[model samples]
Target: MASKGEVHVVHLYPLQMSIYGDLGNTRTVTARLARHGYTPVLHRHHPGDPFPEKAHLVLGGGGQDSGQARVQDDLAVIAGRLRELADAGTPMLMICGMYQLFGNAFVTVDGDHLPGVGILDVTTHANAKRMVGPVVLTTDFGEVVGYENHSGATRLGAGQAAFGRVRSGCGNNGDDGSEGARTGNVFGSYLHGPILPANHALADALLSYAVPLATGRPFEPAALDDAIADQARTRQIRRLVG
Candidate 1:
C-alpha cells in the first residue's frame, strides 16, 4: 500500500492480548526504523475503538487461549477495518493468537468452536500433546529461529504459506511444520521471540514492503552485525535442542 507520507504501525490489543515474546515484533519494526534514521510512529488499539487506516504495517502477536477468546470478541468489532487494510495491501505481521483469529475458526478443548477473521483458509484443533521448545525453519530465505508453545493442530490446504517444512519442531498449524504464513501483504505465523532480532532478513523483508510506501524510495539491503549473526546462530542451535 502506498503511504500517506509517514510509516504508521499499529499494535493491536497488546495490553490485553499477546504471548511469548510477541511484543518483540513491534520492537523489531521500530528498532529497524530507528537504525534507518526514521522515527516510526506506533499506535495501539483495543475493543470499542476504531482502527486507524493510515498504516503502512500492522502487527499482531501471540497470546494465551483465554486472552485469544477475549480478543476474538473485540476483534470482531474491527474485523471490517482489518479486511479493508488487507485488501489495500498494507503489510501485516501476525503471530500465534493473531494467526488463529485470522483463520477460519478455532476449536477449543470443551467442544466449542469459534469463528475467526476468515482471512486464512485454515483451521485449528485443540490437541492433548502440547507443542513446546525451540524451532528451526529452513526457508528459501534461510534459517530462522523461534520458540513454540501450543496445544492445537493447524491444517492448511492449498493456501499461501511462509515456510516449507518443520526442520526442527512444531510450527504454525501445530503439525510439526511451518514457521509462519504469507498471504497478500499479510504474514502470519507461530514464530515466537517476536521473530526479527535474530531473523534480520525477515525484518528487512517486512520493512522493504512498508518503507518504500512511506518514503517513496526503494529499500536497500544491509548486512547484519557479525556478533549478532553469531548470536542468532547460537540461538538457532539452542532452539534445535531447547
Candidate 2:
C-alpha cells in the first residue's frame, strides 16, 4: 500500500490514565491508520514532558483517583494549548477520567476538587455506586457499542451537544439519556471497551477529521474490509441490548 499522509497522534498521559484497556484506543488509531494507508506518528505526552506543537489528534484515557492527581498539574500546564487546539478543530478523544478532566471540574467523593481544562461544558462528581456494564448507544455515526466502568456522574451544561443517546446502560450521569459530550471535534465519553475497536465508525470519523488537518491535503478514505469487525460489534451489541 502506498503511503497517503501522516497523522500526528498525541497520547496524553498514557501512563497515568490508561485503565480498562483505554490505551488500546490509541493502538486502534495506529492500526486503522495503517489500514487506511496513512503514516501514523505517535507521541506520548507524559507529565512534565513537552507537548507536540503540531498535533492532528489528541487521545486520553480513564484513570483512578491517584492517577488523576498525578496528571492534574501537567494537564493544567497544557490546558491553554489544548484549548487552542480544540478551538482550532483538532480532533480529541477523552475517555472516562480524561473525560472528567476535560470538563469544568471533578469533585471527588471526599469533596476534594480537581480543576479541569474547561474545554467541555460539563462537570463530574464521584458517586459511591459505580456504573459498570456493556453499553449500546445511538449516535450520528450509527449504533455504537462499548463498556462503561465509572463512578463519576457527569452533567453537561445546558444546550451542550452530547456524543450520543444512551440506548442501553448508564451514561453520563445515568440520570439523563445522554451519554457523552462533544464540542467541535473534541469528544468526551465514559465508554471504554477500549471504544474504538468495537466502534470503528467513530474511529473513522476521528481519522477523517484528523487527516486533512494534519496533512494539509484532501481526505479520501479508502474502502477497507471491516466485515469481521462489524460482525463482532453486531454480536456484542445483540448480546448486550437484546
Candidate 3:
C-alpha cells in the first residue's frame, strides 16, 4: 500500500446533499492519513462534473431521501465511469444513502422504485422507523464504531461485505450480519459518523485497499486511541440501545 502522502481521496457527491455527519467521515479519513505524514488530497465532486481519474480512494456520504432522488439522475450519468474505476481497482467507500444508490434500485416510501447504479447486487427499501444510533461492527480488519441512521432496508447480494457481523444497531440492510456492502475494493456502510474517527481498523482497511495501487509498499497503519473516546461514545450507545 502506498503511504498516505501518495494517496488521493475524493469525496463523491458532497455538494447537493449530506446526511448525518457523512462529511465528518471525510475529515476523519484525511486526519488519519495526515498523522502518518501522508498528505491526502481531498476532492469534493458534485453533479454534472467530471470525476477525477485513477483516484486511490473515493468516499460517498449519506443524504436525505429527497436529495437521493435529486442526485439519482446525476449519479446515473457517471455510473459507468465510477464502475469502471471500481473494476479497475480504485477503492470506494459509500455510506447509507449513497450505499443504497449503488444497488440495482431503491424502493422509496411512496412505492416508487428508482434506478440505481447497479454496481452491486443489492436492493434497498424504506423502513418505518428511522434507524438512528451507535453501531459496533466486527470484520476481518477489526472492530469499528459508528452510527446508523436511515429508514432503508438493505439486502446483501453476491457482493462481499466491507466487514463481518455488524454486532450492533440496525444497519442499512436491516440485518445484523454485516457492516456494509462491498464489491472488489468498494465498500458501502450505514455508519453515518463517516466511520473513520472511532474505527481505525476499518479506516486502515480502506487505506490498505487504495494505497497499494498508489504506492507499491504495504500500508503501515498508525495507532489510534480508542480508550479516550470509548467511555463517552459507548455509554451513549448503551443508553440508546437499552
TM-score for candidate 2, residues paired by index? 0.97
RMSD of 3: 3.1
Ranking of candidates on lDDT, top first: 2, 3, 1
The best candidate by lDDT is 2
Each prediction's whole-model lDDT (CA): 0.75, 0.93, 0.76
Selected candidate, larger TM-score, 1 vs 2: 2
Clashes of 2: 0
Q: Is candidate 2 or candidate 3 better by TM-score?
A: 2
The number of the candidate with the highest TM-score is 2
**Model 2 clashing residue pairs (backbone):** none
TM of each candidate vs. truth? 0.88, 0.97, 0.86
**What would the per-residue lDDT of candidate 1 be over residues 1-242, giving only the tens digit for each residue?**
32224578889888766657788889888877766656689988776677775788888888788888788777888888888878877788877778878878889999888788877767888888888877787765577777778786777757557654678887865554566666777877777875777787777778888878777777654454547755876777675756
Model 2 per-residue lDDT at 88 = 89
> Judged by lDDT against the true structure, how good is candidate 2?
0.93
The parts of candidate 1 lying over 4 Å away from their true place are 1-5, 162-164, 173-176, 220-226, 238-242
Query: Each model's RMSD to truth, in Å?
Result: 3.4, 1.0, 3.1
